[model samples]
Target: TQGPHPVWEHGLNGRGQVVHVGDTGLDYDHCFFRDDSQPVVFYPQKNEKHRKVLSYQEMVEDDGTRDHTDPYSAHGTHVAGSVAGNSIGGNGVYNGMALEAKIFFTDLADHSQSLYLPPDFDYYFRPALEMGAGVSSNSWGSNDVTTYYVDTDRETDVFSYFNQEMLIVVASGNSGRRMGILSPGSSKNALATGSSGNNMMTRNDLSSFSGYGPSWDGRIKPEIVAPGQGIVSAQSDGRVNSNNCGTTSKSGTSMAAPLVAGACALIRQYFMDGWYPTGVPTPSHGFKPSAALVKGMAIHSGHPMQGRLGNRGGMLKGELPEDAQGWGLMRVDHVLRFADSPFNLHVENNVTLKHRERWHKCFHVDSGTLKVTLNWVDAVAAFGVRRTVVNDLHLTVDSGSAQWRGNRHTNDFETNNIIETVQVEGASGTYRVEVYAKHVPVVFPAGQPLALVLTGKGLREAACPQTCGHCVHGQCVHGQCVCNAAYHHVDCSLCDDDKLCHGHGKCHDEHLYKCTCDPHFVMDDCSQCEAGWYGPNCDSDCKCGDGHCDTVTGIC
Candidate 1:
């Protein structure tokens, strides 16, 4: 009856939350979501309206009123249905990942639409993030030639916000060109989803129209792949909609993005009690996974489906190509298992420790940021790091005792997704790094190498205990936990944007990328999409085309 339900059913749904689908709005009356009518927050600024929901059209001239309808764009409608559609009349053709998830439509189609590219896109993203949407799916992108970082004009380019607060998925562009992933989509922060197929047996091959990676900076692109080619989902108008609900032989990274978004919603639902090691506070609803945890779990656990043809790839060793299936196929089931596991991290008596020795967990430390040299036994190099990974070294410390107390001083090291290195310089003292991770699959546990290495500079010893703030458990003295140059304090935890500190401070772990909004700046994050533009993170414009948004201003 529930049609297999949302992949991650145990977590938050659109019920108590709102997920903004930035695209051409859906045909609201589509039976998929209409049968079990749910309230949708319609932001007309995007120029979208539901004929079945709205009585009159916006001030704009050409687009028809409530009664007159246009041919259903199977693309947008399918994406929406996968997210909030009610599967009642679904006929199994279209059942949303988060059927109960709320919908906020930012229609980029209309010129006079209140939420046009200018303001609506810019303002909408922050509002949604601040309000705490579970996730947002944008199955659109552009071929514009702009640096993927903070754009001056496009205010809606909030991919960084999505990465910071909630999980945001974007289509890796369907141009089939070499490394042609559109602007924001190509950005690293966002989880760019590619397309795969229905059958789960084959290896996930690179789609013809799907964009490929190695961003301009040479970072891996299109984090993961999903079913996109010839995908069959919901439809708006019935004529084009097959009686078997709505099936179409479509192709594009657009179709692929939603499947992952839906799957993520399901994982959030399944693993209701947040994973402990992630350090996410017990959600108001007890426990909910954070975007980082979700991303990490999904990427690490999902089945390896790469090195195949026509999308749906394989998962075994050496199955997919490095470029085609970056990591592997989207494994909905593995993520669920991670959610149900017992994992935790703690620092006691100047030692940091992590448990649940199954997943790849490490305590990262930076240079200068010295510390009571933390070392590990089983945590060996699981993944290799590059030079740019200067900030990516972890330590697995083991306190000789079991201290799980909720003390913010020792236990709380919140900065980025990884731990900040504490400057530890003192007489050579033995500190055991303890790690509780699955050395290898239960079946294959030997030679997998559980050896761990706590990376950092070997510093000169400190004279006394009280040298730097009584030698905080997770930090080093005289070798205190120092923030980066632009950063202030350990983990660079606070953003000066809120006017608390000056000169653009960095917020510790949670809000790492955001620059504190300086004085007189409109946005609190100090980041803004220059005037005449707007989008999720101020990355895009109202660039529209026949079926695409305008290139210049993001207008249709």
Candidate 2:
């Protein structure tokens, strides 16, 4: 689903996007960094793909120097190729995600002392953001610790909280499920990933080396799983030609993260191009989504795995936010393919909530199940503080007859994690979704911004909007005003441009709509996979990346 095949058909291949890579090294001269149409692996001295590697910095240097000719190791090159590689050299057999996204590299192999101590998270990421990179990928971490909330933990949260648009994807280290977690991977805001087998359909498919959560603070880390075992990608040999560059297979959570990074690039581009409401972008329809919104969409669309293990190591039939798999394997196709959902979906992209103020929204759903997900970039706690969750919040789903709190993992209410989800099944009724400031010791003056996603079958809007004394923003559907403002709520059932496009634009219809193929996908024929690479011609099922869908649900 994330291979940019059919996604390329929808006019999204990570054009006009840049993601930062924190790694040991990067081979900037690789031939796989170009488009799929290039048959020959030989690149010119000044190739257009040279621009693909935006900027490179050395994070390990103590005195701050650049070795322009320092050939990178195989890991960084593989990670980069997995993120934005094309199959030009591999006969379209090994394509990467987001084939057009630019890369910003930060080399962390200088053997600096700070690498052993607490990291200055802000120091590592801010420079990349200045280079116009909002998304980041980190596939390296310390494996010595079981579970610990170090300074890097709070720093990661601090950087994300302050830079709300940035989405950082971290590897959960190869510390195994029994081990606690790595430092910054356990950070509250970063999207920590675990290792999943090629097809994560059963418990047997989960990786034995993948790290599980129940973090030091007792919150679930490794929020999602992806394929990382026996994955093949471009290998580095300090050459930009196909004859010199080779392919290698590696297994670790490190391999799983770049896939998520590339998938996020496509997902990010989906919203950036204004393809959400319709196939085009108008004034009201398209705008940048917060990092929390992207993270929530990934979680809400995830297909919950079966045979999850309990705390005592016994098997549990079905579990929400399982320790081993978090919210199950990522099913990004379910989110991008808006028409196939079996439930109604609503989104509040950028909701800024103040301290001590409660945000409430009421909706109606069927008797089957209701899933509400809340994700935010929380304000960071002080360093050396055992309690890393500084500004705590809780989500409660109320039906007047019964109530369900969000992610009651270990605490009475969730107090350690920045992401919370409450899924409940009950008789049909009007349900209220509340985001309460359970405790906010440290508060941002502008208020903490969060994203909310609700999905359920037979879903529609109930009452309770205090704007214009009624609903004037969105059109009424199914005998109720379902489509509210995007910041307020977005209904999935509404297909009209007027109702759906009003998300970012609020009721302004003056802007014209046009779809130009300037910087969208790579070329005219978007399929990068060759005729017999993985399937016949590219119409058939060919996976350039390593994720396999669930057998029952068909989600990846």
Candidate 3:
């Protein structure tokens, strides 16, 4: 039977990834397999021929037989279901970190050997990342008599470089010693996990058997701890008497890593959805809780993990230990909140206004440049970045500064949007040039999008002296200002002579009336008389007057 409820379901059920379980072996036909297959999104090897795409359909034993011709190892099956088995019986106390995540499993556990290395461990992990799988869980460990600090023949860095995107979580061995930390788990990059129990009331100090760290390289081990002791999850064979095994109980740092792995998956899903229990942009990716923000938010927001554990170190007294518990217990809710909220800087100038009009919402940017000249009324001090010149419209705004001297630029403006000389930075790309209201300092593409809305009202309020009067901020631009030209009111308050029409022709304005040029004369404003007509209004019957004007013939 399964154990009590899992502590991490309060946040997110792993929703957006495929988790790879590198362990002894798993039975894919089990109920948990229903929700366990996630498509590969990243691939490490492209041109290489030896690389193979992994899947449950292709899982096999060393003998190449699909069935369990060998012994049935429930170790991997239990781990697999916890990391991603479908929540069939509701028997699952906690959903796998990547519940929707596909599982890429392999049996690397060799019982007879003291120190074993599966040939395809690196092969599977490397391609899994290239295919976009973000997390990998290793439940097995080895105890070599060799002294600490001894580097393995296969350098950890070699595979790590290719698997940078994958967060590999390994168990800190169950050897129950002062420092029994194992290989691969000893790697600097691996997030080594220790075990804790679900019964939080009685201070369940560190499990005596969970391996200790301060690896040969001197980095802390058991980076974090979770509910590993007496943990229960789906079994591979069948439920009870049937061949389709059901739930099983087990313990070790192995159980702890999957708890965090599932938490990581929840964190990814929360931020991407753009919501918060309190309606704030969910906070994410910050100074990992060495226990400040988590406690602070927990106390303020009914978060379940308040003053739960009593750690030994005085520094970790009201807090969780740094070396053993890492950042206290796994709090997925708080972790997801941190990942969703962030102060980010974004810049883009290449987007065409024509295409932007199609979007119901204005592009969200915390900071950066826009390729086209933006026209808006009173821009906000926090969101506005910079404004620029386009065509012949000399728009004006003083909210932010810019250094758009054709891409190769330096010198940032603290208060005003800098107007550097424009250049052809992008030959065939959409861009925006806007004047922001605040002079925020940040690098380009600074992670997340700021929670601000760019709308027509905001743009109109930050009106440009030159471009606004042409049409609405996002509307089409008509030709030159006919009324402004004829009336001599450069600002275009009225038509020429206050007569409504241009001296030589009709004025085009909000009204839409048309007037023909007077006899013998033709010019944009209808101001110039023909070559033969000389008198001021051309009414004195000069040589080129109306009736005497040459039409078809050259002479009058």
Off by over 4 Å in 2: 1-9, 34-51, 58-65, 68-73, 110-119, 146-148, 200-204, 240-245, 278-284, 307-317, 337-343, 366-368, 408-411, 425-429, 464-556
In terms of TM-score, how similar is model 1 to the real structure? 0.53
**Model 3: lowest-lDDT 10 consecutive positions:** 449-458
What ranking of all candidate models by lDDT puts the best one first? 2, 1, 3
Candidate 1 residues 1-556, lDDT tens each? Answer: 1234323344444344445565555555556645233333333422123312221112222455332122455456677666666654545445565666555554544422222343344454554454445667888766564344434112332334223446677887765445556756655446677666555343345565667665544544566787776665666562322322453445678877877776666555544544332423254433454554445444543345534443334332433223445555776543343333332222221122222122222233323321221211111111222211111123333222221111012544311112212223331332333222211223333312221212233322222222232222244435233433433322233232223322223344455454554323334454444444455334444443334553235565
* Best of the two (2, 3) by lDDT: 2
Each model's lDDT: 0.44, 0.66, 0.42
Candidate 1 Cα outliers beyond 4 Å, as residue runs: 1-17, 35-41, 44-70, 111-116, 119-121, 130-132, 145-163, 201-203, 238-249, 270-285, 309-321, 338-556
Q: Tell me, what's the RMSD of every candidate? A: 16.5, 20.3, 23.5
Ranking by TM-score: 2, 1, 3
Model 3: per-residue Cα lDDT over 1-556, one tens digit each: 1343232334445544556676655554555554233331122322221111135323344676443211254577777777776665456554455566566555454432122354645665664565555666777666662244334312343354333345666777776445557876765445567676656552245665667655543444555666777777766552222335367778888887776665554443443443333323445521121111211121111111233232433222323224444434554432233223322212221222220011111222223322222211111111121221111111121122222421122332221111112222222222233322221212222211111111111121222223223221133223222332334221233333224333445455444345456665556545556655555545434454455654323345
Query: Which has the better TM-score: candidate 1, or candidate 2?
Result: 2
- How far is 128's C-alpha from truth in model 3 (Å)? 1.8
**Model 3: residues with Cα > 4 Å off, grouped in runs:** 1-11, 35-54, 57-73, 109-116, 119-121, 145-155, 238-245, 271-321, 338-556
Scored by lDDT, the top model is 2
Determine the C-alpha RMSD for candidate 2 after optimal superposition of all C-alphas: 20.3
lDDT tens digits by residue: candidate 2, 83-188: 8776544534666677878777776654321232224777788876777676898887765673455767777887898798879998898867666568678888
